[model samples]
Each structure stands twice: as C-alpha cells, then as structure tokens.
Target: MLADALGQVPYFSAREVEALVAAWNKPITLRRGEYLVQHGQVERNLYFVKSGLLRIYYPTETEEICVGFAYAPNVVCSFPSFVHGTPSEYCIQALRQSELLGISKNDFAALLELLPNIARFWREELEKVLVGRIDREIDLLLAEPERRLERLLRRSPHIFQLVPKKYIASYLRMTPETLSRLR
Candidate 1:
C-alpha cells in the first residue's frame, strides 16, 4: 500500500518507507460519525487512512462547512495545529467506518529526525495541498454556483455521490436552496 502511495514519491526507498510505517503508534479503527479530531482541541496526531473516508470541516455562523475530504491512501489532520502545537479551529470526522495508521506529532518528528528525506516529502505534500486549496479558493471567487459545482464534480466526482448535498452546498459557498436550484 505504501509502495503504491509512494509510486510518484521520488528518492523514497522501500526500507525507508518500512521504517516510517514501523514508527506509527498504532492502527486505529473508527466508526462512521466518530470524531477523529474535534474543534478547539490541540491537534497532536496525523492519520493516514488505510480505508474509508474522513471529512475536514469547520463551523460557520450557523452550520458546518466541509472544506475537504480524505479517502483511502490519504493523510488527514489539522496540519497547522499539528505542526505548531496549537489548538485546531476545525474538526475531522469519519464519514464511514475507517481504519487509519496514526502517528503523533512527537513520533513523526522523531521519524523526520531519523530520516530527513521523509521531512522533505512531508513538506512537498503540504505544498501540493496548499496549492490545491488556493486553486479551489480562486475558482470559488471567480465562478458562478453551477460553474463551481461543475468544476468540483470534474475534480472530485465521487464527493458528489458520497457526501450529503447540504455539506456540498456549504463547501461550494451556496445555500442548500441555491444548490437545489442548481441541481
């Protein structure tokens, strides 16, 4: 699984990947609706999903807005808090029964200490995620609701099928009624 995930990760050796996996605290299983990380909590761990989906959300004035999702072979966490040792403003929840390999901030730092190459990989991953977020923000600002929904579907078609329409509406910065009209 790690090999498949790292297929495009250059300079990563199989042995190094093994070492990284060995460093994880444990594999945890969560049921649907379970809170992986709660808002205002100090985020100290990163979860690598083995199977299932996780939703990253934040509370708006009156509702929860799902900002993103992580599926199998993806990593999910409130990265800023984990990296800075601060409380998270967002929450992550299991959207389905999930299995994850969890590594605490301390353990991950130790792994990076032992293998600086992994640190480089982590940094690169963060850059890619940030870029994607920026592109999404730009699209949302420039596009109409239907256009935005089309773009989102083009990028992540499965999300439309998996997540509820209400969450999707919030993510698209539209009201549920507007989303219904678009549909």
Candidate 2:
C-alpha cells in the first residue's frame, strides 16, 4: 500500500520505495478508538496507513468535530505539528484496527536530503493537501446541505467506505439524521 501511494508520484521509482520503506521501517498498530497523535501532543512522526481507518477530529468543550480521514494506502500525520514541531490541533484516532508504518521527523528529513525524488513527491503531496483543504472550505461555504453532500459524494464517495455514518456526518458539518435524510 505504501508503495502504491508512492508510486502515484511522478519519478518515484522502485528504488525510491525501497528508500521510503527503509526509512519508515518502524511498525505501529492501533486498535479501534486508540489515538495515533492525541490532541496537544507534539507529533514528531509521519505515518503511512497500510490498512484500516482513522479519523482526524478537533475536540471542543462539548464535542469532537471531524476534520478528515485516512485509510489504507494513505499517508496521514498532524501536518502542522510534523512540520513546525508544535502541538497537534486534532486527535488522530483509529476507527478500526490499523496497521501503520511510522518515520520520525529526523529520519524523514534525512531521507529528503538523500533522495531528490522523494522530496519532489513530498512537495506535490503537500500541494495536494493544500488544494484539498481549500476545496473543502469552499464546499462548506455553500448554504445548502444537499449541495455539500453532493460535492463530497462527487469528489470522494470512498469516504463512505472508510468511516462510519456519524463521523461522516460530522465531517460534512451536519447531523447524522440530516445526512440520512439527505441520503
């Protein structure tokens, strides 16, 4: 799965995959409801999801608001924390038993210096994340719930497969009942 994710990058070769696997060779596992990076913790690692599902959510005084999700073959981390050595704003929790590969910031930095292709790939991934966030913001700005649901369904119907209905509702900024009604 890691290889498949990396393989999507331009100029990412088998050699690059080997380098990535070697750098992130540490295996990690999480059962359902277990946190990968708890809120307020400094997240020093980048994670590659081999299998299972995770939700990134922001905790408030009353509730946890879903922000995003990660599933099989996906790379996920507290990006702000990983990049700036800051505390994470969200809790990354496994929604199902999850198998993952983790690499520390130091190791990833070394890999970036050692491999140019990996660096390019990382930049492109970051760009995509940025664009995705912008797109999501635009989606949320729409006043109608149906439009929001429609856009999400059009863009990432697979999210329905990765997470449960409640979290999906939260991610869409709607109640579970509302989501159901719309569906």
lDDT of each: 0.83, 0.90
lDDT, model 1: 0.83
- Per-model TM-score, in order, reads 0.87, 0.95
Worst 10 residues of 1 by lDDT: 1-10
lDDT of 2 by residue, 111-132 (tens): 8999999898888888999899
Candidate 2 clashes between residue pairs 3 or more apart in a chain or in different chains: none
Candidate 2: which stretches are off by over 4 Å? 8-10
Worst 10 residues of 2 by lDDT: 1-10
